[model samples]
Target: MRSLIRILTTVKELRWYYWGIIICSLLTAGTALLTPFIIKEATDEVVASLQGRGGGLSVVIWLAVALLLADLANTIISNVGGYLGDVMAARLRTRLSQLYFHKLLTLPQRYYDTALTGTVISRLNRSITETTQFLQSASNNFFPMLLTLVASLAITAWYSPWISLMLLVVFPTYMWLTTLTSKKWQKLEGEKNTHVDIAGGRFAEVIGQIRVVKSFVQEKRELASFSRHFDATVGLTRTQSRYWHSMDAARRGAMNLIFFGIHALIFVRTIQGVFTVGVMVLLIQLVNLAKQPATMMSYLVDTAQRAIAGSKDYFEVMAEAQEREGLADPVVGARKQLAPGQPMIEFREATFGYEDGDNVVRGVSFDIAQGERVAFVGESGGGKTTLVSLLLGLYQLRSGQVRVAGHDITETPAELLRGSVGVVFQDASLFSGTVRENIAYANPDATDEQIERAAREANAHDFIMGFEHGYDTLIGERGLKLSGGQKQRIAVARAMLKDAPILVLDEATSALDSKSERLVQQGLDRLMQGRTSVIIAHRLSTIASVDRIVTLRDGKVDEIGTPEELAQTGGIYAELLALQSGSKRDRKKLKDFDITA
Candidate 1:
């Protein structure tokens, strides 16, 4: 396939290994050819004259020794080829993993929003694994089998032209049958893989929402649905396996027919004195050599399909439209932030969307002074998240630009932008590692004192030290062992350690109880000192202290002013505030008489 060819071209760097393994494999085939000659000579020359000739015994002994040496040589060659194949496989796998990792990091954020998490994980894990497996076989087994077939046919023709011609007749037929079957199976395999992906996606979704399922008491229904989907996947795999096994069986039967017919013709010729016994014996070896290539037809066909599939998947990942970086035509730095003064951020008429004509944030404009604190507020589906995403340079603007300090985000190098911005999402995630490692992730080289200071600034130090292992305590996957508030605090600590001048907090306090929220707010106040902060929150009270408030509607700015100014205007913001205030009052009144008593 075109995809397969592209993947093969990408691996041109491994050509040396390919050649090395090819040489060893061909040498092994040569040893196999020598096998027939040794057998034929031992039979006719040694056994026939043993009753009379004195030199017969010694000839027989040398011939036997030669056979042993040839077999040993073949074994050594095959082993060497296998070693080379394995080494090449390991190298390719490492390169692939690194490529996928880098690709995932560099792709635009919209890609993540659209693709399923499990599908990506499976592609990176199983898809690449399948490709590597096929590569190993292609080098070690497939090439050797082809060489054996060619060498055996040439040698057969030298001994008996008629038999060689017959083999040639069967070879093309065998190849045709194998190729047709492989093509069919290749199509089936693609379908099977799709079903597998669906099953994986469903399984992952269920695991992720286990809490909801439990709350709804829908365990029985969930289990039944999962079983049905899993069974469907199994059915597809079973069909593929049956087809593959049947193809192999048919190929084997065809091979046996050709093998027997060749031997019969050769034996009949020997009876008519047209061939010597020694040559007849040699013919037998030649016939087997001829069959060696055809016998491996099924395996080769399967390997080819796997290689094609693997390459297709590899290129699918590669074919993703990569994010383009700004050119270096004009040497002027578009944005600069590392100066000794305050760092300011400005969005000049910025507009953006994941796709064309679907603007999620249109004509947005804002400016944060050196150390000003601003908060974004709106109802669900507002552009608060999109705006924050743009500020972090995860998504490029359709029109206008964002400047960090004084540099345009697009023109600033990716690494430089990442180093300058720190963000903590509403749902905090941490990798499986020690508490200390998670806190110090942003500043890996930070000393213990520095790490503790950052944690204190995020109000995470007290609870972390209370653990049995203190900073050494391990957090499970995604920091599942830690509570929501704990995770947020650790995330804040990480951001603090980075010491970036710009911070974006997305509902960072939503997960905390009142007591924890108060403690974290104190630490946040400390961290926000002298830095530009962008806060996104549903609870307007949380952003009451900010210098300015920006309310979004649909995908555009609906209002921008101080909290007091927005409330006095009796607009959308005022109505929402009054509704929340009245709801809170009613809840308090439900228990008001108890305080008087």
Candidate 2:
């Protein structure tokens, strides 16, 4: 209930919608109860007129007018109530989706690494959908049914006490079974949703990595894996349906039997001159009111329970602790921005590990003055990439200080810190967008001339123009339409267009052949000319002209100096160079980085 209340509280802005539903619901309930009395008065009026009593045709006209007014008002109010409910549901759904998506962006890097995109996507969508569904059922079905049920019983007791007394005897058993089935359905729904999401996850995983699946020739294996999830979902749904239908069959049968039993007793009393035609009419209408709620009870509970179960997953994500900007000073609403006199990049006694007291990067410190090109080279898992993560404010530091443009990284806003630097990763990730959109991704406001200049600097201008649409051509997903070299060049071109004060290139040329490598290297040269550049050198040749080469071994800085200077030291850099130039056996050792000459 608290969880349900928390979900409701998020839409405080739409309180008017909720209030409107309640007001209309009350009016509708009142009108429905009045229906029995209106019939009773009409029946009495007709009989009295037929028997030539004091009442005449005037009574029938007044009763007809009252019934018409009540029904018309009820119809208008119910329609308005339904409209408000839909509006509230839409607002809640949109709000929840925004919350989930925004949280996805704010969550730490580790969350993404461990989380499956398919599973998360399914949960996010289902949570919002289910939460709104639950709200609607509660408002439209559960609450209304309950209110109507109470009013119907009172009217039944007033018309015929014996029938109402019989209702009291049967109500408890009906409610007990309904409550019991509702709980079971909720549990089943929760389990079914989990399996359903797993099925969605499997579908996403197999399709997203279709290239890998095809290369591995694992079509049969993948299909079998997907089939397992599908079958489980089907089996659970079948069981749930069986239980539901069986319970419904029982509920309807019992309610109908009770209904007829009361009817027979009423008929007997009427034949014995104990009740008039008007009284009989009122009893039938009142019985039907009771039966309506009784019949709908299971369905309403099923919808409500399913909704609550699904929304649980949604609200769980909403409650996640959000990461906020750390202030340099204890001042309210003071955001950290670029402060003057900070180094282009500085790491002081920096030590970091994914887990506590376990450092993957230990006590490493470095400085890259403005416009200096430095390269980081190391064996795999020696924390070459972790350093970039630290500088970018992607991870929280275990200890020490990382300052970027003079402001502490933790103190600076992540968006501003990243905006200050341009990056070209080896993967060459591009969206399913046009060439123009992809190039101007970082700076959407860049002029056409600036975009062309960046493309020319990247050696991508000529090839891009070769397409009939030029910059307007669709690149497809992750730029699949382009070759590896074309993709990397475009990625570099994108970085060039960003034109930040600092640049980081992680093995930017590792995947390119010699001809493509030379082209991309020239583009990189143009891009890195005046920026503070950091390169993670996978190939020894790529870092030959760097101002300094920082060697890392076992998570600490092994050595730092020029390539020529390190070549003479017989250290890790020298050892790497020797190994690369050695026999075929030594070549396999550095194959991960693919730095062959």
Backbone atom clashes (below 3 Å) for every candidate: 2, 1
lDDT (Cα atoms) of all candidates against the true structure: 0.77, 0.81
The deviation in Å at residue 301 for candidate 2 is 1.7
The TM-score of candidate 1 is: 0.89
lDDT of 2 by residue, 184-300 (tens): 777778788888788788888888889999999999998898788778878888988899888878776787788788999888888887878888888888777777777776766
User: Which ranges of candidate 2 are over 4 A from the true structure?
Assistant: 54-58, 140-143, 154-175, 178-185, 238-276, 326-342, 355-358, 592-594
Cα deviation of 94, candidate 1, in Å: 2.6
User: Residue 405 lDDT in model 1?
Assistant: 74
lDDT (10s digit) by residue, model 1, range 122-199: 677777888788778777777787788788788888877778887887777776776767777778778766666666
| Position 36, candidate 2: lDDT | 73
Measured by lDDT, the strongest candidate is: 2
